[model samples]
Target: MQNDWEWFNNNPEIKKLMQHTATQGYYFILYYMYYVSSASSVYAGLAFGAPIMDMILPLNETREKIPSFPTNYGIDGEKYFILLGIHGFIVNAMAMAWLWTTDAFIIMMVYHCSSLFNIVGVLLQQLNMKNCNYDEQYEKKIITEAIIVHKYAIEFAEFIEKSVTKVYGFIFMVNMIMMSITGFYAVLNFEKRKSEAIRMALFTVSQGIHLFLNTIPSQCIINSSESVFHAVYNCKWDELSIKSKNLLNIMLTRSSRPYTLTAGKFYPVNFENFGNIIKTSLSYLTVLNSMQ
Candidate 1:
């Protein structure tokens, strides 16, 4: 995997692609951090008797006191509140750090794997029949290099799938439950607690975004992998020698199968499954709402 990355970076074209990917990733992480920070601030404000927004007033009115300590504990003072607020802020920051690192790492790997497939596709598509006919050695070398890179890309994707299976599966389940509960609370409190309702709504949306982050990359992998087949097919393979044609056959066979990632080896992580998650969460929300 390390050598594969080194090879990817060594190519100027791949380096450019990686640079663009890195730029996009930078902005994505920035926006997500800002969003999570705002949410954390709002939550901290509500719990620590600090008002970050005027809309929080309605929510604060419902609370008898700041949740710094249990009433029976009798720890009631501005100093205690401040201390607890500081502690809570530190804890939230740590949690956000963990979330950002884990999710960002997974997203980065997915993007790279997708880019690898795309790179292979582009290389295959650039193959010229005239050049291949004139220079058999050149043809063989180019095809061999593409095959190796394609194989490495596939192996890298498999490694990622194995590593992230449990993590994505757990996240999938948690996000579904969070989306359902938050959606239910958002709707249930819409009239009486507008602020709380909005918070819950945001939580639901965040979960949706989280699920999208996982599924979209998996979809990209599928799309790029399939494109490899098209790339190989579109090339003028008929003019190549028998050995070269045989090599192309190998690529065609392998690229015919779209690469995929799964959650818990059960649900395929793709756009279709993403929609199903939303629908399933909504169904659960409806059931909860009915019970209420």
Candidate 2:
């Protein structure tokens, strides 16, 4: 794993990006930790303390059950309602822990992918701006190296995309669903449980930030990939020999296609898709509100 990381970080651009994103990733983890802590506290309280508390404080009837963490002991579907809410507590705690870890992994993946794309973009830009000498062999060697670098970068991005596309799709769908459901509950129950509502709101926002972090970098890569063509077009290509010009034309043609990171190939990650997710979630929330 260390060897693989070393290989990935071999590029200066990639190393710098990794360092920058590590700090951001840490912030995201911390934010998620707060949300998880707040949410799990409420869940733990309700899951374990509800039955006992119900005898005193009493639970609101309108609130959802099953969420009450009741264990039905009788065969006739009768709830024992024993204070054995430990099972619910355990399950909730485990799931929340899993989610927190998963969030960190997802954040890391996004940063890694973004860094690779950024490095590729830098390579393309450098290639376009590289000075060509009058020495034919020297110019050829430099341009050839640039081409190899560009191809290497493209292949690396493609590999990363293929390996993570399905994962990205899953994360996207799950995050959006969580956002919608959490936002709906947060807004609907603001009066009943202000702290719970606030926790849900924070969860929703964290999910949004997670999605944004992935999509924005994807959009940046897409834009950067396209920018390569412009870079090539504006370069000092007129000074090159016919052979060099032909090689550059080939590179330009290849770069024109660009690289894209998609979510299972069904959806491309971008700001536009991110907006659509938010709008769709809001629409669902609106409908749910109207029903309530």
Per-residue lDDT of model 2, residues 260-290, tens digit only? 6788878888888999988988788888888
**Candidate 1, residues 1-292: lDDT per residue as tens digits?**
3665587777787778766766666776676668667766665555554433334656635343344222333565544755666677777777877887887777778777877887887676556644534666777887898898799889988998898888889999999999999899899989987766776787688779878866766887798788889888987876677888899999999999998888998878999889989999999999999999
Error of 2 at 97 (Å): 6.2
TM-score of model 2 (CA atoms): 0.65
Task: Enumerate residue pairs that collide in model 2.
Answer: none
Off by over 4 Å in 2: 1-133
Candidate 2 has its poorest 10 consecutive residues by lDDT at: 62-71
The TM-score values for the models, in the order shown, are 0.83, 0.65
TM-score of 1: 0.83
Model 1 residue runs over 4 Å out of place are 5-11, 46-83, 129-133
